[model samples]
Target chain A: MKYLFSVLVENHAGVLARVSQLFSARGFNITSLTVGETEDSTISRMTIAVDGDERVMDQVKKQLNKLIDVIKVVDLTNVPQVERELVLLKVNATRQTRSEIIEIVDVFRSKIVHVASNELIIEAVGHMIKIDALIKMLKPYGIKELARTGQVCMARTE
Target chain B: MKKTGSEIIIDTLLDEGVDTIFGYPGGSVISLFDTLYNFSDKINFYLVRHEQAAAHAADGYARSSGKTGVCIATSGPGATNLVTGLATAYMDSVPMVAITGQVASKMIGNDAFQEVNITGITYPITKHNYLVKDVKDLHRVIKEAFFIARTGRPGPVLIDVPSDVQKASCEFKKITNVEMRSYNPTIKGNIKQIQKAVQMILHAKKPIIYAGNGVIISGSQNELKEFVEKSGIPVTMTLLGLGGIPTDHPLSLSMLGMHGTAYANRAIQESDLIISVGARFDDRVTGKLDEFAPHAKIIHIDIDPTSISKSVNVDLPIVGDAKGVLKELNKIIKKCDIKNWVDYVSDLKKKYPLSYTKSDKVIKPQFVIETLYDLTKGDAIIVTEVGQHQMWTAQFYKFQKARSLLSSGGLGTMGYGFPAAMGAQVCNPDKLVVDIAGDGSTQMNIQELATVANYQIPVKVLILNNGYLGMVRQWQDLFFDKRYAGTCLGRQKNCKPVCAGPDKKCPDMIPDFKKVAEAYSVKGYRVDDPKDVKSVLKEVISIKEPVVVDFRIEQEENVLPMVPAGAPLDKMLEHGLS
Candidate 1:
């Protein structure tokens, strides 16, 4: 099963490394991790996606909470949550295929961030499923480069 | 008052009631050492030969005294060396605070000399770790480190201070109180859960108490004894729980698990109820999990909630400090009339008593340990290197008090005992401290002899000098058809695969331990004759200096009453190839 944890930690050096190390050393697989500074500069928020059974996920949550830098950890998997990911893909394009690519980008509500003579850099932001779908659609155009800002998640307000 | 980070560290340590520190000096920590020089009257710092030994020594000190052990080292390699020791303490839940000097703040991440991300590296191993970014935070960090290290399910904590921070001056304010909202640990068991546990105990007909290192960690030995006596239950200890109850007690089954006693294993197998206190059902203790104590209803009392139901399912789980929970349990539980169950366990004990061959020509390892036990009257603090010798010592040495038997239980780390013995000896100079070590394990951290000789610590190192890595050799002998692949420690380069037995001629042992001891300027003795065991042990124990006694025991011996991996505890091999 996939579990998502929203962890708020002290914005300190090596905090990210510590979180990643905890997962790796304990043999817990991390599907995706996104860390960024919160409104308060001294605090950082991390959205970690992990794959494990209930027992393993429980251990991961407990171990993460045990870290000194971590202030709070919330398992957002079972909760009503909103998750988003951003992907930037550079695809090879010819004059003939450029119109087709733009039409597909319009249908997905994505933007052509950069356009070159033979390449188009497409930027997409949505839930993980949508981002993955857009990437899958662009795969046949010969992806020149790709980068993803792993999933960031939040609990839905009641 | 204004003080440097170094001064704040010293003042805080003194305020925490820390009198001794184990450490090694390096460039990054030179300022801290210099500051320590001025406070020699308040602190006694033992300079270890290696940083790793410093950590082990501190762990030993912590386990023996129930105080948070302190060790310090420089950044990079020095800090890295402490990893194994920290991991060992972490696994066993020993309370220790390790202070390491990091590179200057500006130099961090620039790959400067002596720079390492120690805080990041020790994250998984430590209960909590801090990197002192500002000198003002030094005092608070030190206090938190000690508090976290000593409180609830204690484990190692690391504080990494950059060199610049140690030298930087800040307005020092003494922290008289520390309250971390996110870090409060549960001290008392839930009332409903405790009631459930008591109910389970009352209903149980054949009940057993399984104890572990937490009993020693919480200093709840008396509470545990009272609870067991009131409940009239048989007690079985883990390796770290050896001294939780007197080994010779009528209801005491010394140890249980892979290398545990036959009767103890049999009782665990047949018991209807198991009351586990402070013990995490480790894989070593639970063989073939599905078949482990299938008939038993488990009531687990542990300080750490995660440890409960982590390995084995439980009928009832009480999360609280062992001492607190046991006190509550003793107050509520009544004496049970389970004479039939008690008699059945006693019969099992009598039937499968621990025994070994009485050899006249060769000294068995068990005999050597028994002699040591007899000479010390089970009073000496026994530390051990992991292997056959460690198990034998745990089996033969009857520990009558908590914190008397200290070993790397969870990690099963080799080369832990020698330095650990030194640490224990330093803390208890008036008491005897001995490291019962194996030939292979002794060689791993043998350089600690220099530290012992330099400090004049009266620690005894008893090396059971079997020619092979005895435990692995035993496995190869049993399961691998005696192939002896890479298990022989002293095999000659040109020696035949099928070497002659001990009765015939065989290659001599390498790096003779007596000579190795002599090289470190310590007294050394070698005893090959079985008759010399008692006298040699007595002479060494009487010595006022660190001494090494090499006992050339029978080479083909293996620890018996052994339950093979993934096998049921009831199925034990009583003898070697019997």
Candidate 2:
């Protein structure tokens, strides 16, 4: 099973190391993690995706909460939530393939952020599945480079 | 008044009501020591021989006095030296504050002399840590460090001050309180959960109370006693939980785990309900996890919620301080008689008592411990180093009060006892403090003898000289076909790898302990005759100064009722002894 957790921790040096250390030390499998500053400058929020059974995930959550820098932890897996991820893909394009790439991007509601003589940088923002789908469509044109900002999530307003 | 960071630290420690500190100084902390000299009248600082011993000493003081133990060290090596001691304290939940000096702020990451990222290194082990780059933050950091170290599930906290910061000047403001919004620990167990736990207790048939160090940490000995007595539930303890209940009490099962009494292990295996108070189900206590207490419904009460259900599944978990939960349980607990179960447990106790063979020639370590217990009337604080000697002491020494027995339970740290005894003696100068040690472990931090002699602390070091690492030797003897590989301490260069058992021809024990003690200017004694054990112990106990008595006991004695690693508790090897 996959579990998503929202952890708020003190914005201090070595806190991220502490959290990651906990996972490595306890042998918890982390699927994806994204950390950034929260609304408050003094705190940082981490959206972590982990794959484990209920008992293992329960321990992961509790151990995260045990770190002194960690303030709060919420398991958002079952909650109604919105998740988003951003990906950038640089694809090799010829004049003949440029039109096809633009057409595919238009169909997916993504945009070409940069263009060079032989390359097109496409930016896509959506749920993880949509971005992955966008990358699949661009794979035909020969992807030169690809990068992703791992999933960031929030509880949806009812 | 304008003051240096060193002065701020001294003032803050005074405000924290600290009367003693254990520390070793170096170049990075020279400024702090210079300031300490001026405040010598207000505080007492014991200069330990090693930084690690200083940390353990502080740990011992904290456990014995219920006050946060404080230790200081210099940069790099000094700070690293405290790692083992801090981990020991962290594992056992002892309250300790370790202050380490760092290199100048500018030289921190440049690989300068005596520079280390101590706060970063100790982050996982410490409850919290601070690196005060600004002089103005010194007082607040110290205040917060103390609060964090002594509160909730108490553990070691570190404050790393750079050398330049110590020399920097600022206006020292005395802060009387620390407010940490994110650091509050759960104190009161939920009322509904408490009610549910009480209901479960009421219906339990074969109930057993499993206690741990938390009972002592939370100062809930009385509450635990009341709850156990009122409910008539038998109690088993972890190593750190030994003194939580009177060892001699009829319902008391001294300890339960790999080396626990056979009856206690049987009761745990057979019980229908287990009420765990402050004890995490550590692997040592659980043996083979899948088969441990398979039929029992566990009710775990702990201040640290992570400790619950982390190792063992719990049916009912009440996350709160032990004293608070025990008080609530005592209020609502009803008197229920499980006469049959009690009788069964009593029979098990009688059938397999903790006993050993009596000897006439060589002294058995257990006999030495038992005699010490008899002479002290079970009133002395018994600290022990790790190994067979430690297990024997735990089994034979009857602890009647909280904090009566101090050993490195969680980390099983060797060389913890001698220095810890010094710290305990400093805290309770009127009481007799003894370190029950093994020959292999006593030498780990034997340099501490200089500290004892210099400070005039009357701590007795009783070394059970077995010449081999007894625990490992026993394991090899049982499982490895008696192939004593690397377990021998005094093996000569020409000695065979599979040498026969200890005999007159074996090389002499290296670096004779009596001479080592004499080199440090402390009184030393050696006793080999079993009949002279009591008289030697009496003579050493009467000494007004620190002394080390090396008792050369039987070489082949192994701790009995042994449960092999990963074996279920009930499948104990009685070693064919009657």
Candidate 3:
């Protein structure tokens, strides 16, 4: 099963390495991870997606909590969440293919961030499914380059 | 008064009630050493020859004294040298704080000479670590290091302070308490789980207690004994868990694991309920996980939540300190009717006693261990390096109290005993401290003899001089068709044209250990006959200065009652000859 955890850690050097090292060293599979500063400057918030069985995920949660730099770990998978991921892709878009690519981007509520004579750099933001849908729609145009930020999330109700 | 970072370190240490420090000076830590020199009267700092010994010594001190041990080292190589010791302490959950000097702040990432990111390197091994770039954070970092090391599931913590921080000046402020919001350990076990354990233990026809280091760490020996007596349940200890209960106690199964006693394994296999306290169900103790305690429902009580349900699933897990949970269980529990179970385990114990194949000519390592135990009346603090002799000491020496037997059980580090004994003796001047060493391991840190002699630490290094790394050889002999590779300590390296083949003419022994001891100004003795083992140990134990006794034991002797790795408990080789 997949589990998403929102971890609050000490905002200092090497905190990221410590969290990632725990996953790698303990053999926990990290599906995706993103970190950024929280409201408090001294604390950093990390959104981590882990893939493992119930037992493995339980252990991973306990082990993450064991790290001193890790302040708190909240299982956001079951909680009502507004998870978002951002992806940027440079697709081959000749003058003939440009109008069609812009139409597809518009349908997905995405934007063409950059445009050259032969390519269009499309920017995407939404649930992971929407991002995957956008990439699938643009696959025919030949994706010359692609970059993604691991999902970041917050509780939906709050 | 304003003080340099070095002075602040000394002040904080004094505030923490640290009496001794095991450290070696280097260029990066020159300022800290100078400050320590001026404060020598206030704190005792032993100048170790190697940074590794400093860390091991501190670990030994921590394990035996039940206090958080401290060691200091300089940057780069010196800091790296402490890695093995830190890992050893970490694996065994020994409370320790290691302070290492780093390159100056500005030169940290520039790859300056002797500058390494020690905190980054030791991330996996240490429970917590800090790199103090700011001078004012010195007190806070050191204070946090000690607190993190000694609290909850205790383990080693490292603090890497840059060279400039030690020189930078700041006002000394004492941090009495470190409150880490994310770092609170569960101390009290849940009433529901305790009740479940109590009912299971009371109702089970054949219940056994499997305990380990947590019992000793919690100082729960008396509580364990009381519970054992009240429940009429037999107890088995892990290697590191020795001395948690006296071996002579009728209910005490000396140790259980790969090289554990035959009866202990039998009891664990047959038991209907296994109450695991403080033990993490290490692979060594569990044998083949699939077949481990097949008939038993496990109740695991450990302070560390991560330890519960790690290797073996627990029917009930009580996440609390051993002492506290045992205390609570004792309050509401009535005596259990386990007479039949107790008698059954007792019968097994007598049926398969720990008996060695005796060699009457040259000394047997078991004889030396038995004689040493008899001579010391089992009162000595016995430390051992890793190998067959270590297993022998664990088998033969009946430890009667907590912290009586100290060895690198988890990491299995060789050369741990000699310096560890020194650290134990430094803290306990009146107690008899002995390091039962293998010839291969003794040579690893023989340079520490100078430090031992200079201070006259009265530590005895009893080398079971077998001319081979006996443990690995035993494995090869049993499982690998006796193809001895580099296990022989005296194997001639890269044979000359005129040299003989590997098997026939290798020198039996390398350096004469007695001469090595003498060269270091420490007294030395060598005994080749089994008959003289007792007298030699007796004589050495009475010596006021550090001494090394080399007992040239039968080289082929192997630790017995071996459970082949990944084999079931029932598959132990009760007697190799049989």
Candidate 4:
């Protein structure tokens, strides 16, 4: 199971590394990790995605919550979460396949970010599954390049 | 973003998840103490009789609870007093954070009355230490110190807060995270190395697994057992490694050192392959390195890289977490033929097992310890005091699980048992917690009986009442001519004299342990007869409240299988392979 947690922590050097290190040292698999300053300059919000059993996830949450710097830990995995993943994929599209690729991108509401004589760069923003499926579809079309902004999630109501 | 000193210190502690601190009040740390008092409702403070006890209590809490233990002390003597406790935690790798009060900024290094460079003194033992000179940096320094203490190979970390800094006000900003490039702990085991280890185990005809404290510290008992079960290797544990494998398990050989089982010693000597996990080849275990497991091809696994090849040489050294490495090794070891190796080790066990002779002259400490095993069946956790009693308990008591035998193994702290037992009981309330102490060692921390009584902590204490310092006597008996020196309890310094005859006027100062227990309003039982010792221990441990049993025994009994000072493991006498 995957868990997405947004933690509010005191802004101090090494705090981010501390969380990541805990994950790495414990052998917890992290699918995505994003950190940035919050509205309060003194506080930083970190979104971490981890895969583990329920018990392990619970322990992880409690352990992270026990850190003195952590003000609050909000698990956004189940609470009507707004999850977004951005991908920039360059696919080989000659004259024969260019029109078909454009039609597929239009169906997914993606935009053509860049275009060359034999390649097309498509940018899409959605949930993890959508990005994964898009990557799979583009693989058949010969993906020339790929980059993904690992999952960043927030509470839907907030 | 900057904060004042006092708030920052509290914030850092809060960040470190410290809810309880054991400490003593003093001059230099008055401000910190005052702040602590104000925050009393939120952060708990346990007042201790001495600074040393505070440290031990913290260590006890950390060991059982699996959280960083916190202790606070004032400057100079208070700080110095904590050295023993810090060293104990450091040696055992307990996660602890010590807060000390330093002299005022201007007063420091002026030959200030209460000022001492605590950080310098604790440098060698601590995982890391800091002296917070500036108030603004207090919070960050404390947060970072806590981070270092509890992470990687966990150990104690100290922070000396100047008195003035505790008074200086700062903003209450907390540090939520910490990142240090040089501090990353290695997590993954090298696949190639693990595969090689598997291959060695498969081909070896006679292989034995030498387990150590590393298995317990890494929390990898399951992994160790899995590896052993799959590889069919016989396992021998060190004194500290006793509980890493269930002692009753068919392949489990209780301990492998000075007093290790005969089968374990023979297995190590004759085995073709040796797998040492999370244990250093201490002189006690490897008497003469050249003769120690000379026939075995050694494979050493530990989280600390330096531990590899430090004492005995290693053919295959895997540098990673014991649990992680064992997990990887288990996967690869699944396809191996270790049946012959297992049978060879089992044959050794059948030939020369761990059996002791019952003495006809006096009550042996080993017998009393074995009684503890009979009563508890190695189910309860056993804590012990230093001196001959500690070694005897390690030799005689059978430990069936890890974290079950909590003693001052590395520091050999004499007064450890009573308080440590009390602490262990706090963590394991339902399980029976017993402390086995020598007469000399028990008196060192007997004051903690009050703590045990006050908390209503049902800790069973078995004081092996041998009137002399037994270990010292053993050394004298071995090295010096049997002309007794000051090792006797009737010495002038101790202000006591034995009643030898009717005419002899004995010193009026012998304190009866039963009376002492009565004074504390705790139950006391005395076993004068050797025959009744086992029944008395069973009754005491079975009770619902704290019970102390003083079993007076022969004075000169020594812990056998001892290697003389600077002797090698294979050179151990009294007991070993034929």
Candidate 5:
């Protein structure tokens, strides 16, 4: 099962190495990771997507929690959540196909962030399904490049 | 004044009251070393031949002194060199803070020359580690590293500072508190478990107490004594457990394992109840898991849960601090009588007391160890390098005090003695420290002789010189049809074309250990007479400076009470011939 976890750690050098070291050491597969300072300047929030058995993830949590710098860990899975994945797709756009691409983008509520003589950059933010659908529609137009920020999720309500 | 990372690192070390650091210099750490050079007037540094030596030396310093020892290295290979030492400190729970320089931040992930993931490599072993990317975090990280290293069930911590971080300037701020939620180390034993353990000790008819490294690590000697005396249970310690109780105590059986006293091994085998405290039933002690103490209802107490019943079955397992557990065990066992049990075991100890025969009447390694124990009266801290010398020291030396015998128990690494002895001495400077080393093993870290001399640390080195690799030869003699293949450590392997000693050209080069000692300007002597060992040790220990006593013992002598690697602990063969 895949679980997304947010960990707040002391913003110190080598903290990332420590976290990645823990994951690699225990053989836990990290699908994606993003770390940045939170609203609290001293704390860095790390969003990590990991896939493993429940027991292995539990071990990961317990071991990671043992680090002195790691302050807290929250599993964001199964919470009434708004999960978002941001992806940028660049595709070959000819004058004939430009209108067709715009029609496809309108259905998915994505925006064209950039345009050039030969290409158009389509930016989309939604769940994995919404992003995958956009990619499928653009694939026929010869997608030049694809980059996706792996799943980042937040709780739905106050 | 705005402090650089280099200054912050030194200032924190100074605040921690660290007086000594073991290290060698290189380019990445030069600025830090430069700062150290400025502070050299106050702090002492021991320049070692190898960074590994510095690590082990720091380990030795910490284990003995009960303080966090420090070591430093340059980037890349210098940092990697510290890995073995850091792991050693980590395994033995010695408090050490290893400082290493890294390439500049921009150069880190670039795989630039002289860059390695030192912090990454040490994650599993270190209690905690830090990398100082900026000067601002230096003071806090250094303080935190020391606090974590020495606080509870102490272990090594590493701080990797990039070259830029070390040189970068920032304001100095003192950290008064560190809030760590997940890093809480339990300091107290569980009351319920303690009471249960006490009940088990108090009610048992034939209880044999087994002590391990935990007893010394937790400083639970007094509690151990009270429980043993109150319950009248005889105590037998593992190799790591030596000195938890006085050797001459009626209840104390020196050590229990393959070559353990016949009585201690048999006592556990026959006991109705066994209270094993602070020890994991290592294969050395539990020979054949099924046959080991089958009759005994076992109560195992240890701090680490993974250690309990991991190898042998246990009737009761308690996880908590050894000292806390001992205190509770003492409270519950107010009074008890095991006169018969004590008497029976006492008889076994007296009759077959650990004794060996030296057929040539030459000074035996056992003789040197026994005499050393007698001379020091077991008050000296005895550290040993691994292999035959380690086992021999365990068997022959009587440890009458706790934390007095330090050796590589789990890892059993060779060259552990000299550096570990240094650590032990650093912990308790008032006490004498001795490193019992073998010729081959000592050579591995023999370079520390300069460190000892430089610091004027009075750590005595007793080299048990035999021509061949004794332990391997013993196995070969017993199991390999005496082929002696790859076991002979004679000069034939690398004979000297010409000798350098008083005698002219000789076929062999026996590591002029005395000359090696003298080269360091330390006192040295070779004891060729077995009869003179006692007086020599007595006279040597009287000296204030570090000295090496190269006692030449019989060549083929093997340590007894052999369980032959794969054999069950219960079925240990007492002697090679037997």
Candidate 6:
């Protein structure tokens, strides 16, 4: 099973290294991770996606909380939540297929952020399934390169 | 008041009620040492020959006194030397604060001289670590180091301060009250969980309390004793938990696990319920996890939640300090009726008691320990280096009090005992501190003889010189076909360089520890005959100075009642191949 954890830690040097080291040393698998400064500059929040069962994740959660830099850990998997990932795709586009690609982007509610004679860079932001669907829609045009900002999540307000 | 980082560090040490510090001077730590000179009246410093000894000494001090031990070393090699010591303390959950000096802040990443990422190196081994790039963080970092090191599941915490930070003066404000949003340890067990534990204890017919060093760490032996008496449960302790319950107590089953008593193992395997308190089910304690205590319903009580089910599955877990939980359980729990179970286990004990070949012709290591135990009346603080002798001391010495037996149980570091005895001796000036060492392990940190001689620290180091690394040799004899490769410590005259090599230095004396001791201006004694063992140990132990008594016991002797690795505890080899 895959588990998502929202970890709050001190925003300073070696914090990320310590967090990642804990996973690596313990043989836990990190599927994807995204980290950035929180509202307060002194604190950082990391959304870590891990692959483990209930027992392994239980250990992961407790071990993460044991770190001095970590403030709190919340497993957002069971909570009513919203998750989003921003992905940019560069597709091979000839003059003949340019309009068709734009039409597909418009249908998917994405944007062509960059354009060239040989390529069209499109940006899409949505849930993981929606992003996958957009990529599936764009893959036929020979997707040149792609980059993803791993998933970020928040609990839905009551 | 305005003070430099060095001054703040000394002030913090004093504020923490620290009277002694173990450290080694180096290029980067010179400034700190200079400030220490001026504050010598407030605090005392012991100069260790090696940084590793400083760390072990601090560990010994911490384990003996229940106070966080402090050690300081410089960067690079000095910091690296403390690595083994830190791991030793970390494994045993000993409270220690280790401070390392780094190169100036600007040269931290430039690969400057005497600079190392100590905080990075000690990440896994330490409970927490900090590298203070700024002088202002020094005071708070020092305080936090002490607090974290002494908190629940106590462990070593290192503070790597750059040289520039130590020299930089600032208006130091001591942090009187420390409350961290991230770091808070649980002290009290959950009421529901305690109730569940009580219910489980009441229902189980054959219950045994497996205690560990946590009983001593929490200073809850009295509480544990009360719980044991009230519950009427037999107790089996780990190697480090020898003193948790007095060895002579009717309910105490001595020690358990690998190299433990055969009866204790039998009891655990046959137990219907195992009430584990303050003890991790280490691989050593649990042989062949699938086969360990096959019939036991485990209720683990530990402060660390992760340790509860990390290795062994538990039916009930109460996460809190052992002393606190034991107290609560005692208040609510009633006496158990396990008279039949007790009789069965007691019969097992009689059937499989610890045995050794009695010989007046050769000195037996077990006999040496028993004599020492009788002479000290089990009142002395007994420390041991890891080997056959360590196991012998753990077996023969009937510890009567908590914090009375100190050794490297988790890491099993060989060189830990002698220097650790120094720290124990320093803390308890009147109590007799003895290091039951082996010939191979004692030489690891033997240069500490210089420190002991200079300060006249009366630490009796009893080296069971069997002329070989006894424990490994025992394993080689049992499992490795008795080839005896690289295990021999002494060689006869006219030895060939073919197998030992030209540079191996297989000397006739093997540096002859007695001579080594005498050169260091310490008294030395040797006992080759079994008749001389008692008189020599009694005389040497009474000396008010450092003494090394080399007891030349029968070579090729092995510690018995041994369970081979990966085998179930009950399937133990009672006697060596004669």
Q: Which candidate is the best by DockQ?
A: 3
Clashing pairs in 1: none
Candidate of highest TM-score: 2
lDDT of 5 by residue, B258-354 (tens): 7787778878888888888888888878877778877788888876654656677677877678888788777667665677878888888877677
lDDT of 2 at B230: 95
Candidate 2 CAPRI classification by DockQ? medium
Chain B TM-scores across candidates: 0.98, 0.99, 0.97, 0.91, 0.92, 0.97
i-RMSD values for every candidate model: 1.9, 1.4, 0.8, 13.1, 3.4, 0.7
Q: Write the per-residue lDDT of candidate 4 for residues B360-469, one digit (tens) a residue.
A: 45677788998889888988888888888888787777777788887787777888777667766765679888888888888887777777777687888888887777
Cα lDDT tens digits, model 1, B159-266, are: 999999999998988989987755878889998899889988888888999999989888899998899899899999999999999999899988999899998998
DockQ of 5: 0.24
DockQ, Cα level, model 3: 0.88
Q: What would the per-residue lDDT of candidate 6 be over residues B1-578, giving only the tens digit for each residue?
A: 78998998889989999998999999999999999999888777999899999999999999999999999999999999999999999999999999999999889888898777888888889999999988888898888888899998999999998888899999977789977888999989998999998888888988899999999999999999999999999999999888899998989999988888888999999998999989999988888888999998999999998897888889999999999999899889898988899898889888988889999998999999999998988899999999999999988999999999999999999899999999999989899999999999999999999999999999999999988888998888899887677787775546653342223354654878899999999999888899998898889878999999989887778898888899988888889655
- Candidate 2, residue B354: CA error in Å? 0.6
> Residue B448 error for model 5, in Å?
2.5
Predicted structure 2, TM vs. truth = 0.98
TM-score for each predicted model, relative to the true structure? 0.94, 0.98, 0.97, 0.74, 0.81, 0.97
**Alpha-carbon lDDT, every model:** 0.90, 0.91, 0.90, 0.78, 0.81, 0.91
A1-158: candidate 3 lDDT, tens digit per residue: 88999999999998999999988986877989999999999999999998878887788889999999899999998999899999999999998999999999999999999989999999999999999999999999999999999899998886
- Output the worst ten-in-a-row residue range by lDDT, candidate 6 chain A: A51-60
Candidate with top lDDT is 2
Estimate candidate 1's RMSD in Å.
2.5
lDDT tens readout by residue for model 3, B1-578: 78899999988888888999999888899999999999888888998899999999999899888899999999999999999999999999999999999999999899899988899899999999999999999999888888899989999999998999999998776777798877888999999999988989889999999989999999999999998888878999999889988999989888999999999999999999999989999988999999998999999999999998878888999999899999999898888898888898999999999998777797988888888888877798999999999999999999999999999988999989988888899989999999999999998888899999888889999999888888888887888777776687777666443421234455657788899899999999989988888788878888888999988888788798999999998899876734
Q: Candidate 2's residue-wise lDDT over B1-578, tens digit each?
A: 99999989988999999989999999899999999999889889999999999999999999887899999999999999999999999999999999999999888899999888888788778888888899999999899889888988999999999999999998776887798766888899998999999889889999999999999999999999999899999999999998999999999988999899999999999999999999999998999999998899999999998899988889999999999999999989988678889899999989999999999888999999999988987888889999999999989998899998999998989999999999999999998999999999998999999999998999999999999999999988888877888888888888876775788888888868888899999999999999999999988888889999989999989998787889888888886333
* Reference-based lDDT, residue B192, model 5: 76
**Poorly placed runs, candidate 1 (over 4 Å):** A87-125, A133-147, B518-521
Please state every model's RMSD to the true fold in angstroms: 2.5, 1.3, 1.9, 17.1, 6.0, 2.4
Winner by lDDT between candidate 6 and candidate 3: 6
